[model samples]
Target: MKGIHQSSMAVRSFVVMACVVIILAGIKTASPIVVPFVLSAFLAVICNPVITLMCRYKLPKWLAIILLMGFIVLMSLWLTSLVGSSINEFSKQMPVYRAQLVEQFAWILDKLQQFNIHISRQKVLEYFDPGMALSMTTNMLSGVGNVMANLFLIILTIVFMLLESNDLSKKAHLALDDPEMRLKQIDRFLQSVNQYMMIKTLVSIATAIIVGIGLSIIGVDYALLWAVIAFLFNYIPNIGSIIAAIPAVLLAFVQFGPAAAGVTAGLYLGTNMVMGNVIEPKFMGRGLGLSTLVVFLSLIFWGWLLGSVGMLLSVPLTMVVKIGLESSQSGMWLAILLADNVDDKLSDSSMENHKQDDTEQISEQEK
Candidate 1:
C-alpha cells in the first residue's frame, strides 16, 4: 500500500512538471501575441482605481473608460517623444564616444603592458564597444514599440477587463461552493497586488525624478532619458537600479573623465540606498513576502520568457503565483517555502496568542 502511494505521488509530480514545461513552451512560442495581452492586463489593473473613482462620482462607465484611455494615449505620446529625442541626440554623439573609447583602451593597454600584462587592444575593443550602450537602448525601445504597436487592441482589452472587474465577486458567488470564503481569498489577493503596485509606482517615480534632477545638475548628457530608464527598470527588483546606473556612469566617464564618473556613481548609489532601503521597506512592511533569491530568479526567468516586459512584471507575476499556491491545501507548503523568512511554528504561535486575546476581550465585554 505504501509503495502504491509513493508511486502515485511520483506520477503526480511528473505530470505537474510536464504541464509547467508545456506552458512555458507555449508562452515562448506565442510571445508576440501574449506579451501585448499581458501588458494590457497589467495596465488595466493599474488604471482600474481611476475607473472606480470616476464611477464613485456618478459618471457613466463608458465615459470614465474613455477619459482613462485618453490619459493613457497622451502619456504614451509624451514618453515616445522623450525617447525619440534622446535617441536622436545619442546617435549624434555615438561617433565621438566611440573614438574616445578606442583612445582610452589604447592608453589602458599601454599602462598594463608596463607590468608585463599582455592583453590585446583588439580583443578588448571587440568585446567592449562604446556604441554597445546605444545599441542596447535602441533594441529595448524598439521592442517596446513592437509590443505597443496595436494600441487599439490593447485599449479594447483594457476596456473589457475593467468592465469585467466589477462583476468578479458576482461570478465568484456562482462558481464557488463556499462563495464567501473564496471571495475573501480573492479580495485579499487583489488587495495585496494593488497595494504593491501603487506603492512601487510612487516610489519609482520619486526615484526617477531625484535621479533626473541630480544628473542634470551634474551635467550628465541625456539626463531625462536616463531618468525614464530608471523609472522603467525600478519595476524590476534587486539589480535593476544598478543596471540602469551603468550607462549614465559610463557616459559621465567618456564626457568628463574619471572624477565625474565617480560622482555619478555616488549619486546613483546614495539615491537607491535611501529610496530602496529606507522608504520602501517602511511602506511595504514585509508585505511582498518574497525572498532575494526568488526575486532574482524570477527576473531571469521572466526576462528570458518575455524580454524586458517580463522582467518588469516579474515580481507581480511571482506574487500572483505564490498567492494562488497559498489557496490550495496541498500547495500551501510550496507557498510557505517561497515566503521571505517565514517560520511556520512562529506564525502558528502568533495566531494562537491573538485568538486567546480575542476570546478574553469578548468575555470581558459580555460581563
Candidate 2:
C-alpha cells in the first residue's frame, strides 16, 4: 500500500510538470498578444496609486484617470521627440564611430607592443570588437523602440484596467469558494507587487537623472540617450546597469579617448553602487529580495519567452510567481528556494501555524 501510494504521488507530480510545460508553450506561442497586455497591467499598477489619491481628494475617478493619461501622453511625446532624434543621429554616426574605434585599437596595440606586451591586434579586435558592441547596443535600444510602437494599445488597455480596479475584489469575492481567505491572499499579492514597482521605479528615475547629469558634465555625446537606457534597464536588476553602461563607455572611448571612458564607467559604477546597494536596500528591505541566481535565470527565461520587454519585466514577473507560490501551502517550499534568504525555522513555524489553524477549523466543524 505504501509503495502504491508513492507511485500515485509520482504520477501526480509528472502530470503537474507536463501541464506546466504545456502552459508555458502556449504562453510562448501567444507572446505577441500577451506582451502588450502584460505591459499594460504593469503600467496600470503603477498608475493606480495616483488615481486612488485623487479620488480620496473628492475628484471623480474619470477625471483622475484623464489627468493621469494626459500626463503620460505628454511625457511619451517628449521622450519620443528627444530620445528618438538622438537615436537617429547616433545611428547615422555609427560608421564614423567604428572607424575611430579601429584607430584607437591600433594605437593601443602599438603602445602595448612598445611595452613588450606582444598581444595580437587581430585577435584583440576579433574578440573585443568595438563595432560588435556598438551594433549590439543599437539593437537593444531598437528593440525597446519597437515596443513603443504599441504604445496606444498599451495605454488603452491600462485605461480599461484602472476602470475595473475597484471591482476586482468584488469579482474575486463572487468567484471564489472561500472569498475572505482568497481575497486576503490576493490583497497580499497586489500589495507586494505595488510596493516593489513603486520603489523600483523611483530608484530607476534617480539613477537616470544622476547618470544623465554626470555624462553631460563629462561632455559625452548622447548623454540623454544613455541616461534613458539606464532608466529602462535598471528594472532588470543584477546586470542591467552593466549593460546600460556599455554603449556610453564605448562612445566615450571612441570620442574622447580612454581617460574619458574610465570616468564614464566610474560614473555608472558609483551611481549603481549607491542606489542599488544603499538606497534600494534601505527602502526595499529584505523581504522582497530574490536570490542572485533566480534574478539571472529569470532574465534569460523571460527574455527568451517574451523578448526585450520580457527582460525588462523579468524581476517583477518572477516576484509575481514567487509571491503566488508563497501564498500556497503546498508551494511554500518552492518560494523558499527562490527567496534571497532561506529560513528553515520560519518555514517550519509557518507550517505549524497553518496546521494548527486547520486542526481548529476541523474540530469546530465536527462540534
Candidate 1 matches the true fold with a TM-score of 0.86
Q: Per-residue lDDT of 242-342 in model 2, one digit per residue for the tens?
A: 98898899889888889999999999999999999899889877635589899899999998998888988888899878866766678877888887877
RMSD of each: 4.5, 2.8
Candidate 1 residue runs with Cα over 4 Å from true position: 56-58, 102-128, 169-177, 344-367
lDDT accuracy of residue 59 in candidate 2:
99
Weakest lDDT window of 10 consecutive positions for candidate 2: 176-185
- Per-residue lDDT for 134-252 in model 1, tens only? 57766766777788778889999999999898776566455544454533545666777777888888888999999999999999889998998888778888978887888888888
Q: Taking the candidates one at a time, how many backbone clashes does each contain? A: 0, 0
What's the lDDT for all of these models? 0.82, 0.83
